[model samples]
Target: MRLHFLGANKQVTGSRYRLEAAGLNILIDCGMFQERPFLKRNWNDPPFPPESIDFLLLTHAHLDHVGLVPRLVSQGFNKPIITVEPSVDLAEIVMLDAARIQEEDAQYKAKRHQKEGRRPKHTASPLYTVNDAKKALPLFRGVKFREPVQLNDQVTVTFREAGHILGSAFLEIAVKQNNATRRIVFSGDLGQWSTPLINDPTPLDTADCVVMESTYGDRSHKDAGTIEEQLANIITDTTQRGGNVVIPTFAVERAQELIYYMGKLIESQRIPTLPVYLDSPMAINVTELFHRYCRYLNEESRCNFEQRQTPDLKFPSLRLARTAKESIAINNIKGTNIILSSSGMCTGGRIKHHLRRDITNPNATILFVGYQAQGTLGRQIVNGDPEVRIHGRHWPVKAKIAQIFGMSAHGDRDDLLHWLTAAKQPPKQLFLTHGEEDAATALAATIKEKLGLKVTVPDYEQTIDLT
Candidate 1:
């Protein structure tokens, strides 16, 4: 068997992998490159023929993990896209939103380039159209967790809960060759332990080889218990100053977690009753999905909903701004309020609009509750860039910048170590991916030193043979 590290090898954004075994080609993920340095990769042709792959396996609905499906389909990938059932619903919402955004961005860029009397190196069309996204949707095949599905005579696969977001999963694949069976485990973005909305990552007993994520391999998160207190303080300080608390959130897990915490804070009277606006239509749709799949949530969140006789995500002061006009109206409100919007990394979305409007207000607070990839607008703002370009104009950074590390959905160094300890026996080899160079290297060293396991941090497009 051979493994190809296509993307997310020594970086935090794009994530793709290919496995060639038992005369079959399986692609793990086909994600978009979001970091500025790799953005051109999105327009490049697939390194391998799309038609040559037999099947596609999606780990979750995050854009960095599943954003390029439409583009792949447009390039002739015609096989079934398999994932957990809830991920199908979420992926549809995510992909359609991505398509709309790409279309809008393409049009805007074209007009601006024309005004500047120059043309872009590439065609000014969207990466893929809405119709392409629709074409990819029907090919999705959702399965129940832990059910073994035979892919062919030599391969059987099972999905286990990853606990990162709704319907996120890690894949356990067994491949048979020459009367021997070898097991491979893929850790698909493991979540933090005891997270509020999602269950803990499922523990695995054994595998011949393991491919894991190391997004936070270099540091530990703050005490999770203090997250609520930190959020309360930020909100209180910003509201007291009569300024909005603008947050750039991921439409999936991060946005929901924020709402869950805010609801708890309000119920306990730990924070004042300030109007809170959910300003992205895509995030609003995801919030509704949370209701539909409430049973999948953690025990505490499920119990909270049961006791309240209402969704835990809803609170008296919360408002869903689903229309553009409603979003615009949020700026007209006189008093202090809280606004949560997405794309989490501020690569695009309504969050940029919110940032542009409030970034110059020293009283305002721009809160980031998730990881910001290098070269992203969120990273620039968080790194204290004096000025940032938004909507074709430079904006000064006068707002207070804040972050709550404990609230991140991804697991930290200790959490990753704890997850590894669940293995009954250390695998023959462990490969770390989906992190920056420093993070992956740090994790590889730790696993080798502390666990006495053979570890490697693969480079982009590097291939490894497993025998």
Candidate 2:
């Protein structure tokens, strides 16, 4: 068997891996490079021919894991794209939104370049169109959690709950050859334990080789209860000061989680009821999915919805902004209303417009409830840059910037270690990916010192033999 690390080797986004086993060529995650320095990779041709891939295994519907599949399909890939059921629904929404954004961006850039009378260095065209994304949708094959799906006579794959998001999972594959079976696991963005809405990450006792994510390998998140407390304090303080709380949210898990917490706070009388607007159509659609997949949610959230008839994410003060006019109307609201918009990293979306307005308002609180990758606008704000360019104009940074670290969907250092140590037997080799260099390196050292296991942090396009 052989494994290839095509992307997300020493970076946080763009996660692609190729595995060859039992005469089958399988691809895992065909993600987009989101950081500014690596955005060029999104336009590059696949290192291997797209048609050569036989199957695409998706762990979740996060853009970083499923964003580039449409482009891959447009390049001649026609294969089965397998993932959990909820991810199937979520991926369709994410890809279509991504294609629309790309097409709009391309048109905007072309017009700007023409007006300036300057030829652009790069092609002012979309990487893929909405039609391309649509063609890729028919290939998806949704499977239930923990169900084993046979790839061929010699290999079988299983999906297990990752507890990261609605339908996130870690993959387990078994390959039989020469009267022996070899096991491999791919840890796809593990989540924290005892978090609301979702169950804890499922643990596996054994594997021969493993590839894991190290997104937060260097630190620990604050306790979950503390996250709500900090969120309440920030919103309450901002409201008392007659300012809004503008949050850059991820459409999938982060947005729903924030809404749930805000609902709880209001119900408990911990924070005064204020207008809470979900300002992105995509996030609004995703919130509705929470109701459809209530069974996938944790017992408390599920019971609260089914038995109490009170959705944890709904309250009298909450509003869904689904149209451009509705989104614009939010800016005119008098005071202290909370707005949640996407994309979470502020790479693109209505969040930028919100930020452009509130980042300069002294009483406003710009809250971040998700991870911020480097070279993105969100990172620039979080890093305390005095002035930032948005829509080609510089804006002063006067707002109170706050982040709730415990709200991250990705597990932290201690969580990762606990997941590993719980395994009945350590894998012969462990490969870490999906993190910046410092985080991966820190995790490697800690694993070596504590577990005495052989670990490797592969580079982009690196290939290794699995013995």
Candidate 3:
């Protein structure tokens, strides 16, 4: 078998990998590069022909993992994109949103260049159109967890729960070659063990070789308090100061998780019952999907609805801002309220508009609940940049910036180790990817010292022969 480290090598975004086994070309993911340094990679031609790939296996619907699907489809890749059932719906939403953003961004840039009376360095056009995303949508094949999908007579693949998000999964591929069976495991993005909303990640008893994500592998989330506690304190303090609490949210799992927590907090009266606006249309749709896919949720979240008949996402003060007019009107509200907008990394979407309004207001609070990739606006703000350029203008940062480390979906160092150790027998080789050099290297050292396993941190575009 030949393994190709296509992307997400020594970096946190753009997760794509290729495997040549059983006489098939399988692509693990087709993610976009969000960090500033790697943005050009999204436009680069695929190292391998897109049409050559027989199948695409997605881990989840997060933008970093699935954003480039439309581009791949536009580049002549038309094949079965397999994932969990929930991801089938979620990924479509994410891709459509990304395509829309790409179009909008292109128009914005073109107009700016025209206004400046300067020609753009390159043609101001979208990387991929909405039609491209639509084309990709038809190729998705959603499967149930643990259902073996046979690619050919020699290869079978199964998706198992990864606990990272709704429908997130790690992959188990079994190959029969030369009268022997070998199993290869890919840990997509392992989640915390006992987190809310999602079930724990499934443990593996054995594997012949393993590929895993090393995001947050260098450190632990030893924050001062739990997510709920920190959230309550931030909201209470911000509300008391007569300021809106603006949360830059991810539309997928993070947005829904915040709503779940906020609903519980309001019920207990831990924080004042202020108006909560879900401003992003995409996030609203994803939250609604959570209701439809209740079976995929953790036991506690499922029981909350089944036993008590309680609305997990609905409350009297919770408002849905689905239209552009409604989203604009949210900024007109006079008093304190909670606004959750999408593009968690502040890379795009309505969160930029929300930040434009609140970022200059000292009373307002900008709270982040997810990891901000380096070079993203969210990272700049979290890093305490005094001034930031947003929407082509510089704005002084006066908002009280805060973050809840414990709220991240990716598991930390200890959690990754625990998950790896779950294997009854150590694999012959392990490859770590999807993290910055420092983080991946740190985890590599620990794994070598503790597990005494042969581990390699492959470089971008590197390939290795496993057999």
Candidate 4:
């Protein structure tokens, strides 16, 4: 078997991995690159010819992990793609959102090039369109958690509960090649243990080779109890000062979690009883999907799910704003109300407007509850940048910014070790992906010291053959 590391090998963005075995080709996580310079270089760096690939297996629907779906379809990849239901629903929004951003960016780049008086050989265009996104949707083949489905005579894929999001899974692929069977495990962004709204990540019995994410490989999440108190305190302080609070959340799980937390905090009287608004259309859609998948909830959240099964699932002060006009209207009538929005990293959406409005006022607070990549507006805020440019204008940062790390979706180093040690025998080679250099390095060292396994981090475009 030949394993190829195309994207998200050394750095954490575009994640494309190809495995060639037994006269079959499988592509995993055909994602788009994010961040400034990397996004520019990777989105257009001529993708591998789509025809050569036989199938695409998606690992959840975060934009950085599934953003290139429409592009792959547009580029001639007509193949069966497999994903869970929530990931399928969420990927549709992710692809369309990415297309809109790319088109908008392309327009700006073209105008600048024209002004420079150099007719470049190429003009920028969107990576894909809304229509392409729609075209890619029908090809998704849904698989249930912990069920083994045979792809062909020689290969069977089983998905385990990954605890990351609603439908996230840890995929184990068993392949029969050269008259022998080999099993490979892909820990697709292992989630933090005991997160609300989903089941926890179940470890595999064993595997011949393992590919895992190292997103938080160097750090541990804060205690959920302590972080909950911190969140309550932040909101109380802001509302006491008569200012609104803005949260930039991922349109999927993060938004739902924030909503749940708001409900708990509001009901517990830990914070003011102000109205809470969900301002992202995509998030609204995903939340509806969550309502549909109540059976998948964890033990604690399932109780809340049963409560929401009542007709009036909404609490007294929760508002789901799904219209652009409704979102814009927030600026008009605002007190100490809390607005949760997307994209989580503050890269786009109504969150930008919320930030530009509330950031200049010292009374408001911005609560960050997830990992912020380098070069994102969320990271800048978390890192205390005095001023930031948004929508071509500079805004002074006066809002109180606080981060609650316990709510992160990804697991910490301890969780990773726990997951790895559960295997009967250590993996033949542990390859870390989807992390920064430092985090990956620390994780690799820890794996060596604790588990005493031979591990290596693959560089971009590197390939390793398992013979």
Q: Which regions of candidate 4 fall more than 4 Å away from where they truly are?
A: 45-47, 101-124, 223-225, 306-308, 311-313
Poorly placed runs, candidate 1 (over 4 Å): 121-123, 223-225, 304-309
RMSD in order of candidates? 1.4, 1.3, 1.2, 2.5
Flag clash pairs in model 3.
Answer: none
TM-score of each model, in listed order: 0.97, 0.98, 0.98, 0.93
Q: What is the lDDT of residue 405 in candidate 4?
A: 85
lDDT of 3: 0.91
| Model 4 C-alpha lDDT per residue in residues 293-403, reported as the tens digit of each score | 776778766676687565223568988888879999888875898989888888777788899999999898988888888778888889999999886578999988877
> Which window of 10 residues has the lowest lDDT sum in candidate 2?
219-228
TM-score result, candidate 4 = 0.93
Q: Give stretches of model 3 more than 4 Å off.
A: 121-123, 308-310
Q: For residues 44-153, write the lDDT of model 2, one tens digit per residue.
A: 99999999998999999999999999999999999999999999999999999899888877787788888889797564889899999999999999999989999999
Candidate 3 per-residue lDDT over residues 356-398, each given as its tens digit: 9999999999999998888899999999999999988999999
Question: What is the Cα-based TM-score of model 2?
Answer: 0.98
The residue pairs in collision within model 1 are none
Give, for candidate 4, the lowest lDDT window spanning 10 residues. 305-314
Candidate 2 wrongly placed segments (more than 4 Å): 121-123, 223-225
